[model samples]
Target: MKELKAFLKSKDVSKSEIFKALKISYDEGLILQYLCQLFFGSIPNISILNLLQGLFKDKEEFSYLDHLKDIRHLMELGLVKTGYSMLQDQNKESLFSLLHMDISLSEYFLQFLENKKPLDLSINVAYENHLEYLKDEFERIKLYTRLSFNPQNLDFKKDIQAYEAHIKKRLAKSKFYNVLAEIFKENKLSKKEQIIFIALLKEEYSLKNEESSSRELNSLLALVSENELEKLKNRALLDENSKLIEKNLIDYDEFSNHFYLSESILQRIVNFKRLDKDKQLRLENALKDQEIFELIEPNTDINDVIMPAKTKELLENILKQQDKKVLERLSLWGIKNSKEVEAKIIFYGPAGTGKTMSALSMAKSMKKVVLSFDCSKILSKWVGESEQNVRKIFDTYKEIAQNCKQSPILLLNEADQFLSTRVESGASADKMHNQMQNIFLEQIEKFSGVIIATTNFLESLDSAFSRRFEYKIEFKKPNFKERFLIWQKALPKNAEFSEDFKLDDLAQYELSGAQIFMVVKNTALKVAVSKDGIFSMQDFRESIEKELSSSFDKSKIVGF
Candidate 1:
């Protein structure tokens, strides 16, 4: 009773208000009124009349006038409405107008009753109760079925289980379930395709972040026997399932001998909140990224970046063409006929020259996200694994690009290993390397999204790969004037430079833009550590000398 009072109070009403509004004197009538709201959304006039006659039939004090008074109060409060006006002639001729409850309040009240099951009434238990109802329904529907029919005849137990599974899946609000239901209902799916799909779903649910539980098709082969697979293959030409691939409902990795359900579908099934709490958390952990690809928000604006004038001009023009309006206009004039626009660019030069910075800056100017692929993490020692990883990277980029207003830029920093020269196939290992290069070439040609790759050795890149790049901007070590600007940009405005600290004199050393930044950073660190955070000529000179020494050691190793 205390819980019941708390429940009503939580809804901004008291237990007395419920009794007064419903015009009920007994607690039984109030309990019935609340239950009526939960199941039927509102207590109809006839329902209230019936409840009172049934619950308080022995009580001589309860009368018809009592119900009418309560109904009128409920109407006045705007909590309920009559289907037809009570004062109208239509109501006098037949039954009284039916009362309808406010759906918003009814739902809110239902939630309130759920936490505190006053009089054992609850809407929160509806889903669980529905399963019991479905079980009865299953038995009723299968009553006439016989087990002696054929070997493939619907086994009553299996049929009931499948039906229950289907119902549970339909309860999900995920687009994956909606799409799956629609496709299976609209199209004639062969038993083999159906089996494959069910296997995929089963594998999808079985994944956990703690284990290597990837739902790869090869992994699923163990779940179903080879004999069963052969039978499914006989019923459908495997090629018939190509439509699924085209729709991206699933992906088949030919190299790995594995099939992958679309990430979107996997994400949906894993994230559906109806699953057990532990199971839901485990699925989330499994699907979480390894952080191999870093998401870089636009931080460096293009104008503030120092680059060759020609490079800046090229980037601006390319980005402008990528604008939706520009592309639409281009299509109208038949100037650009591709279904989607893409700009493949290469930024190549000596180490530390600002190639990577240029990519980040341009991304900022265009208001696009940058997905930086970690080359070391992606390249694998296993033969086929590396190629598969590369495919996953591109596929992920496509998925991310589709969800953004402006497609993100895929940045491959120090891309020499991926875009390296395709040597003659002198050995099996060499052939695999060439194969990797070919796969990259094919994917890049089909790609309709922006990509920027930076490399220190432009000469090491395969000619075929270089030719595919729409723009190749060489990042030369900054000239004296550019170096001075770079140095000025690096300086802290609050810091006072020594009178002898001449940037023009410092720029005489053949240092890259990155080296200049490093010198500034180190000089600042030195001031903070030794000079009580004061900027001076000695700190700057020491930092510059240290950078020169490191550069000389690197040049000896590479003969640069």
Candidate 2:
């Protein structure tokens, strides 16, 4: 109290603690002391003319015009806000008009003068909902942006860091953070992009018109860059291939050189609900309204799938999305825009091959959901609506993809029904088929996610549809080695087997993975009900013959 009094009064201010806390030049400190008194004495806002009049009245020797530069310096330091337009020009005429311009101390500084103690610099605010969290985040963004006013002061950087750490800790307690958390969990955006999103979001919250939220491209680049070289590099964030642009989170105006939040984000602002859920919950609800797609959460790992060595290697490569460096390298090479390993694949082979199994196992390996669609059902269900349900398949998949943080695997079983060679000219029915094929082709061309289409006849697919896929893997019937592994894996460990029941004998049969699975099940059923509870060679031979004889049964059934 005595030090503040001494500092405020005309005395040797060097000994005052308030002077020390000001941390400014003696000349600047003298000007700030006058502003501090003005805050206490007047309406907390004063014109430059009145400020200078008071200063000269109190100290007749004071050269108020020379100290106008000091006032501008104080404005840069955020000790003062230079009216509404901080970017006002500093020409002689503008400086002359500044004598009548109104200014005020920053809220931060004013709070300090009111209490005579430093404000609580620590962030300790707890938010109960996402709305509160967003509002507080908006204020923090404004604070950091204001700090950018004096970028030369490294201390402002430290202050922004301190506030950032505090906000992050506070955010960690919430289950959701709106779009920011959504994009982060999806691995679709970097922090620089997240800042740009939140900044535009804040502008939307303020009572400004639409155009005010749109910022100049150079200013946004400056927000994310520390130097000119870095700014030049950051221009790619607005590139056509960047995630911010590709995901449709931000829209850029080429003619005006401005960037704004996309309409999707703006629509979400008014009624922003939780954009995240528990990972398991997301898998559970991903198919709630997916009438054409069945969501499957797979437990089988790719290692369990019996396949050729090359096939296994390719399946394992799909898990590269789990490796940060691999994803980064792919992104660097421009192979993938987002962190996800986007793939359009065709797993083709005869029936009973392991196309669907491998697809589910690959999804499990990546910890993603599988939205499996039966393309055969398209022809079956489109009976009353022939070929009309083609576009709905891709649209439903896209809707599911948006809700899933991890891009769900789109498994199109029996896609050959539509992807077969398109009919060029024929009757009305043939024209409808061609139109359906054309729509299907358009969707696949624009589709950007992990997608796998399984077909019994890859040879029948149209060249146009085949060209859209980046991978065309053949899932042939397992040979002797693969069949042996499949037989060994499918056999029940708990069921009793006769001493003569050798897997090598079963492996001798040329069975696909699905056929082997069925044979083992049928043979196990026989042993389960038998008196001895044993699986003899006769029971196995009978089951294998039954499966081979029923090869005409081309029905497909999937289980998790």
**Candidate number of the best lDDT:** 2
For model 2, where is the 10-residue window of minimal lDDT? 84-93
Give the runs in model 2 whose Cα sits over 4 Å from its true position.
1-291, 380-387, 553-560
Taken over the whole model, the C-alpha lDDT of each candidate is 0.58, 0.71
Q: Candidate 2, overall lDDT? A: 0.71
For candidate 1, lDDT tens digit of each residue in 203-275? 4444533112123332233222233344244422223245455444565554443466668556644443333
Q: How accurate is candidate 1 locally (lDDT)?
A: 0.58
Q: Which stretches of candidate 1 lie over 4 Å from their true place?
A: 1-288, 322-329, 337-341, 402-405, 552-560
Q: TM-score, each model?
A: 0.47, 0.50
lDDT of 2 at 557: 25
